[model samples]
Target: MSGFPLPPNATIGIVGGGQLGRMSAMAAARLGYRCHVLTPEADSPAGQVSAAVTLGGFTDPATLRRFAEAVDVISFEFENVSAEGLDLLASIRPVRPAPSVLRISQDRIDEKTFLNAAGVATAPWRSVETMAELEAAVAVLGLPSVLKTTRLGYDGKGQAMLRSAEDLAPAFERLQPKPLILEGFVDFAQEISVVIARGADGSMAAFDTVENRHANHILDLTLAPARIPGAADEMAQAIARRVAEALDLVGLLAVEMFLDAQGRVLANEIAPRPHNSGHWTIDACPASQFEMHVRAVAGLPLPPATRHADAVMKNLIGPEGMALWPAAVAEPGLIPHLYGKTEALPGRKMGHVTRLFPRGALPGDLGVEAALGPLLSPLLSPLGVIA
Candidate 1:
């Protein structure tokens, strides 16, 4: 805040070294800035591209001190970073989507509470600290609910569905030492998400809403410029704007919402950093979410979030997704991005493929309905082409 503006070439310190960091580093390089990656993995995806790599535990003060000293500003790829780690780094440089916001986003129970206090509607949920609390939660929320740990869970891990009275014990049995939250089942018609970038100057810009389809609790495909009435689309963006303003959030934030059986939007969760749902921006938008995050953290003014083309982003999960890699790479209008990960295990995000289209193409006009008619046809027919 002291300096009026940080110039390009100022180094950015990025926490976590997954694909998000990798993409963010690439974006930083494009803007004439360098990235310093801090993670324990020597061969981390982000580390490979960053100007500097600090290999150590997230809680290691010495490593964090060295990392903070090396960069002009800091940001993170994930929400689960240690609060202390961020506090240490923030003392040295500005950390966008600041540690205070990170704390609320990192825990499900706190996140839900914060959202509710902000007057955002969410699925009814209760905190569970003990078996008694879990039982009581189930009693109030009823059977057929989801029990999730308060922290460090992603991709359906650390979450269990309690379909009946008999399922409660098992759900609690599987949960680790962390606290938990049990959410009442929501009969959602569809899921949608909004991604936005808030600059340090308090100005905000957002991309179009996206219709998301998930498989086994993992995001599968995201259709950009979600087919909805203009009013409903505005409603979604308004919700995102409210959430961003509530957090006084900086950098990219993804707000996941559920369209209930009644077609009403309800908040599902908040992701403080860039999200998989916004992956299409890399291919479809002039300034992608990754670039926006870097620009915001570096104290640069946010760029226009414009979509040059409508796009479909599909995630490649597990072995089946890996097998389709070669074919995905061969498609003319498809952009294939593979995370530098070996051994594709079940439910792991191996990579993604984005299909770009001309602007304003309808679902049928752009071949979306044809391609997604069966949903799983891409795996069946190969190259995502209909047989």
Candidate 2:
């Protein structure tokens, strides 16, 4: 873990062979590093791109050991990797971002506690382990709050809204028999994310803050250089850097936050790998988040996080996204990236498209939605444009 650099041609093991891993593998190849992907899926996206792949269950000790033995270092694409599996791998080889980062990020209660203890502001929240505790938390936090499982929730799953006393029972019944946390909803002006990479030497680089727009609780679009005031953008980046340094992060970390009506920023959640919001970096920034992640974990010097152009990134969810492929490919300044997923299940993130504009060409007077709508109208019209 203390190695200053891993020479070229070294093997990097990636756990969880999803799109993040796929992109990370591609980035590693660009740097002359080979990738070994370990996942249970035989046709995983990362496996398709990596130099080697070990197909096995994450918790299988023998498979984990073999994977560790094949690679010079290890990193993961998702936070859900079993802690025990990571511990076993760490014993065999180094796991960047560290097991402690995953331990905190995989659980909502623990992540919030760590952030708060590090002097980061989060929504008012309290832990609830039982129906009685849920009731007590409701009484204290009040109505219109979110009741979510402390672990394994993503893309808005494992959550229920408690709007009134009548909602308490139904919400509790739906999410029962699991550890929960109730978070008071914040009336926010914007939802922004700061994607940063921290090197082993403690150096950190942050991408431009992105404003996210969600539909049905799934991230639909991201606009880089968030339309928020300059001061709020700077504050968001500062908070994200503080979180990364506090966690002693060795790879990429995405900090999602809410800019409240009073312009106060509050941390909402953290993703330990490359994030959907940072997809804009692929087309706009000199060094993408995936490349930065690969460099950080591989002990390579970090790249400058500079944006060459203004950009808008849109996720192509399900069949609706596939329908727009023809138009997307024809659009000028548009870059389309597909995950190569076999099925286009509804609400599934199948791919994304980013459109870059000349510097200063995009009008700052218009809001993010307004500025990007015309450019993406062809692809979005069929699915009902995101407002």
Candidate 3:
């Protein structure tokens, strides 16, 4: 904790220039802060809008040093930032969601180990440092399991599904050189996430848990005030709180969980920054996730996280998002956000749209649930929207 306020107009250095950084920079601007975006791409969404842009790879030490010197504090949009790069910047300025936190979240083996050591329940998993060890891990976890790279995997990349004993070697063979982790498949009923913020002074606040729906390993939709039962919601929040305390974290952390058929919540993954599931906060809550993340990282006090509107956020992937933009913009209560991406390649996250309803106005009131069929229905419908 700095034990002092980061006054408005302070410059914050952002390590990645994706949509997350763009959103965070927007929030910082609203609060009278300036952003210096450091990334390799010149036309990145964040770089296009930020106060300053440093075009350099994360491995470029000299560029990172100059970037750190230009800002009062630093934070990252993505978890895959090189440890050596962040270490260089950390020497010059405060890096929130600190390097250590990033290290734990970046590696599957370390992440699961940290969660288990923190007394948090996660999917049963074992680590593999070699091909033989991978076979042993598969035997212990069982067939029909997931083999994930220990590092640099997301959006379902760098992972393989092993349906039988014969699949183990091939799965491991495909992801050679990188260590691995195998977990027994979870027969869960629901997937949800809690976006939490912890200030430098240790004060914490959390947005309502969001019910998440994923397709092809990428998040498709997120509904706030997750349609889960009261007890399940509380349990999820508690788990998030425990994780923040254990990590001694500052800035936003997204905790992903799975609710099994019996309604028990199991931790799935953790992101040490604002996440896709929290996008609904932009249209539904008083303080959006991006704003909270900036506040925490800048050493500002945490604000109350109050959900004033019920909301559903849908991610538009590939060309479909652009093709349907006209309809989205014409829809009442819909808020569209398009990233400054030129090409609309398949499976790429093009943008997102959020629909907000007045407080206490639920899907039942608007027939929204029925309007959203299986093809595009919001994820929270299974539990049914209460507000």
For each of the candidates, the C-alpha root-mean-square deviation to the true structure, in angstroms, is 2.8, 2.4, 3.5
Which consecutive 10 residues in model 2 have the weakest lDDT in total? 374-383
lDDT of 2 by residue, 24-63 (tens): 9998999999999998998988999999999998889999
lDDT tens readout by residue for model 3, 289-320: 99999989887878898899888787888886
Query: Candidate 2 regions off by >4 Å?
Result: 1-4, 364-387
* Candidate 1 lDDT score at position 226: 87
Model 2, 163: alpha-carbon shift in Å?
1.0
Whole-model lDDT, model 2? 0.86
Better of 1 and 2 by TM-score: 2
lDDT by residue (1-387, candidate 1, tens digit) is: 235256767788889998999999998999988889999998888998999998987888999899888888888996677878888888988888889899998889889999999888899999888999999988899878999988888878889989988888888988986578999999887789999999878988899999888877889888888876676677789889999999999888999998776767889889988899999999999999998888777778887889999998889899988987877877666788988877789988888988887888736423664543332454443223445
- Which number leads on TM-score? 2
- Per-prediction backbone clash count: 0, 0, 0
User: How much is 213 displaced in model 3, in angstroms?
Assistant: 0.5
The local lDDT score (0 to 100) that residue 239 gets in candidate 1 is 88
**TM-score for all predictions?**
0.93, 0.94, 0.93
